[model samples]
Target: MPSDTEQRTRAAVPADAVTEPLTDIIDPDNFTPRLLALLSNALVWRESHELRRRFGLGTNDWRIISSLAIRPGASATEVSDFIGLNKAVISKGVVKLVDRGLVLLVDGPRGSRPMYLTPAGAEMHDAMLPISMRGQEIILADLSADDIDRLNALLRRMLEKTRELHVLENGSDVGADD
Candidate 1:
């Protein structure tokens, strides 16, 4: 009892249709939420990488620097955990940043050590702030404040749920939150 157009549309679909490996499930035809998320992450990463290159720093170094900016005098272990990088990588990054006079190492109790941004590093952070804000604006300008807040909440929940799923799947901690 369907119309001719409906019959044609149904005929166009294969009964045993298989999905392509390279094609995105969410973006089978056009932009989807998952595709948008991936694109957003890629764009942000690109911008951050560009900023790091301008500052004579690597992405990892910039990440550590930014992390310390959030909470100065955090230990290397804390930095590593926050940045989601291994200790060896964080150690090398901290050494490089220290060598460049951008960060200071403070001795803590029981032989513990922590890092804080120096004046020069603070200046760099200030310089990077505008660029980061601009990038964020461009990425989220079309959305309303409420939309952005909802999207951010959803993304955070997704991250937490994904971590839980990962733990269940592998029976090991993801340690995503540092």
Candidate 2:
């Protein structure tokens, strides 16, 4: 089932949508939605990778930091479930974060341990924020202000639909890495 926004933003065959003939022989003139998505993701990942190299942060460490920045006091398992990563990977990141003084692990009821970003972690995330924003700015530089807004609207709808599909496929809001 699609949301109202998703239902409204069908990808119509517009003149502007197809900039050039796709090299792919299949899929009707080689227009692959995935190619666009992957290229966009790769661009973002490059920024993230550079941030990690500069800050000495691993991918999992960065993910955990960003996740905790958004939803503090979440357990490693919860973080894993939230990010669809293996619990072991989350646990490793948490341990490293704790050792680096970027995060703190607190014992909770029923033997559950919750995590929070330390002040240092918060600062690190704040510092790295500009890199992510710059990545977006560079990626969308060709689009005008109005086109940017329209792109955001369409992307948001697509994201919502994908989330719904993820939930339906997994049968839960939390995806299991296993």
Candidate 3:
């Protein structure tokens, strides 16, 4: 049974919501994953350039900073897992952040290094937040708040599915070498 809001939302969808039939499997436009990858690549490429120009940091660095901002004292492995990035990539980003005086790595239990943002790092994160939020707003300008929420929910579900598949394939030792 659908809630009243869900029913209304479904009813409000335009008739053209269903796109044209995909003519070929190999066509990029016909593949949802390809389209998603394209979007991710495009967003990362654009943001990386802007971040480098303005902050002397790459997207990965910003990601690490953002992750630390939210989860201070997280380990590189933890941040890597949370961010769905490789551990090596997270480690490299952490190194860069530490060298730049943006992040501090402290000894943790069992030789694990916990990472936290320095005051400068917090400032940097604050400065970059508006740009990130504005970009999100611009990209989502066409979407209603309900639509954006739904889209995010769907994306999170898809991410969970990917994680399930990865665990199945990797036998729970995900990124062991990374």
Model 2 whole-model lDDT (C-alpha atoms): 0.80
lDDT-better candidate, 1 vs 3: 3
**Per-residue accuracy of model 1 over 1-178 as CA lDDT, tens digit each:** 9999989988998988753465534544465666877876886787668786787675677778889999898998887767667878888988998998989998898998988999998887787767667777886889999999999999889878877898898875464432
Q: How do all models score by TM-score? A: 0.71, 0.68, 0.81
lDDT of 3 by residue, 110-160 (tens): 999999999999999998776567668766999999999999999889887
Q: What are the runs in model 3 whose C-alpha is more than 4 Å off? A: 1-25, 173-178
Off-target runs (Cα >4 Å) in candidate 2 are 1-30, 81-84, 167-170
Per TM-score, the best of the predicted structures is: 3
Global fold similarity of model 3 (TM-score): 0.81
Q: Please give the ranking of all candidate structures by lDDT, highest first, separated by commas.
A: 3, 2, 1
For candidate 2, write residues 113-177 as lDDT tens digits.
88999999999889877776786788688999999999999988986787788789987654454
Cα lDDT computed for each candidate against the true fold: 0.80, 0.80, 0.86
